[model samples]
Target: MHASATRLPSAAAWTVGDITVRRIDEIALPPQTGPWLLPGATPEVVSQLPWLKPDFADETNVLRLASHSFALTVDGMRVLIDTGIGNAKTRANPAWHDLDTDYLTRLAAIGFTPESVDLVLLTHLHTDHVGWNTRAEGGSWVPTFPNARYLTTRTEWDFWSTTELDEPRTQMFRDSIHPIRDAGLLDVVDVSAEGTTVAPGLTLLPTPGHTPGQVAVRIDSRGATALVTGDCVHHPVQLADDALGSCVDIDPEQATATRRALLASLAGTDTLVLGSHFPAPTAGHVVTDGDAYRFLPYGM
Candidate 1:
């Protein structure tokens, strides 16, 4: 862990009736992350959307992106959505490799310790998202959340497990993912087009395209609803234009479709939109911006 890591995030949050969703602090991804992840969101494109400046992007038009997770408690069940890039692991991406952030310390500070987590909802099995699934222990990787059931879509599990992985992905699985499965902690759920309810107020909405089985987490409690945009929507720039997609997307066309539909559902609704990769002021409401949409963050 870094010695100077902040004790807490800015503490961004939204309430879904009874559950208080907290944005657990993780490393603020470097500026280079924006270009590589969302190649279509050029400086020209982001400049046109004045709303994105300062918070979502820098003056130079570099989009701001972060790696964080949402945590909450309901009915005595603790739920953590998406684990960020972990520490001391071999990663192909230089920004992610050997990241030694105090992510777990921040999580534990919020009362969601490795042992306290009941459900670890993985949006997808990407390297950054699943890094925390395991930790270097006795020269071998082990499940970080030993007590929690690591839940993911059956489609996602099957695709990765069966497909021939490249060296990087193979290394990722060997270190961060396989340990969970070996520990009998990995559980897959079949999500239909309509979506699947995972817990009392939590539902996994199928938003494929970024990956074969990527699902966005929807939390509804006491009539209030909030949606967590997993990989389906990487950054707020995608909100300005549906065409702006991540270069790593498995299917660009389908990813665009999923993003469009998901944004439409959220447009002008009370449902709080929590972006998995969004920078501070991460949770917000979606608003239409003439032929497109803009993220009206919570504070403003």
Candidate 2:
């Protein structure tokens, strides 16, 4: 069991039929992170989208982003999606290197204790998404959720395992990914053209391009549907124009195509679009706006 040293307040959860998905708030990304991550979302572009102001962006129209995990229970199984930048981990990115947050406490608030989690889903093996896979333990890194199966796509693991990683990425793997694998907790699943259903009403939809194996998690129940967009759609601004690409996108053109297609599929539908990085009121419905689409905040 992961020890809860302290407690912190967490955000609200939205219901998708019987399941209640809560956002375990980590640190809100600094203002600079927005511009750096999605440089194309300039003041002029973001401001033009009137719906993005006051909540999704600042007065200057700088995007608002966050690092968080989505926790929910399905069939008595506790599932956590995309662990955030963990506590006290070394990283080349100053924003992510060796920090502290109340992420664990937030998860526990939603009944997601480390030992109790059955599945830790990784949309891709990105540093931020996988940082919490391991925790500092007696001068060494160990699996944070020792009992849970840390899962990702087979393609993702294959790509990273064979690719030559730079020092920074290698350091992340050494501390985060490697420890989980070494402890025999990592599980790689094959995401097919039709998508893979991990559990009842929970399917992993292939949304490649952010990375070759990125996935968007879909939840369906009681005739309702919700999609947890991993990095496929980083923010609401992207909905306004698919051309606004993230700087970190592995394959820019493919990423844009995936985002565009996903948005098109969700527009004018009832599917609840849950953005993995959207700052607040992250759950919403995608609706068509002019030539592109726009995100209509949930219950709004």
> Tens-digit lDDT track for model 1 on 1-300?
000111244456666787888888788999999989998888998888889978899999999999998898978999999998889989889998888888898888777889999999999999889989998889899999999999999999999989999999999999988899999999999998999998999999999999999999999888788889999998888888988889989999999999999999989888888899999878778899999999988756
Instruction: Give each model a TM-score.
Output: 0.96, 0.96
List runs of model 1 lying over 4 Å from the truth: 1-10
The deviation in Å at residue 160 for candidate 2 is: 0.6
lDDT of each: 0.88, 0.87
Considering only N, C-alpha and C atoms within 3 Å, which residue pairs clash in candidate 1?
A: none
Q: Which stretches of candidate 2 lie over 4 Å from their true place?
A: 1-9
* lDDT by residue for model 2 (1-300), tens: 110112225666877888877888888888998899999888888889989988899998888998988888999889999998999987878889888887887777767788999898999999889888989999999988988988899989999999999999999899999888988999999999889999888999999899999999999888888889999999999989987899999999999999988898899988888899998888888888888888888867
How far in Å is the alpha carbon of 103 misplaced in model 2?
1.1
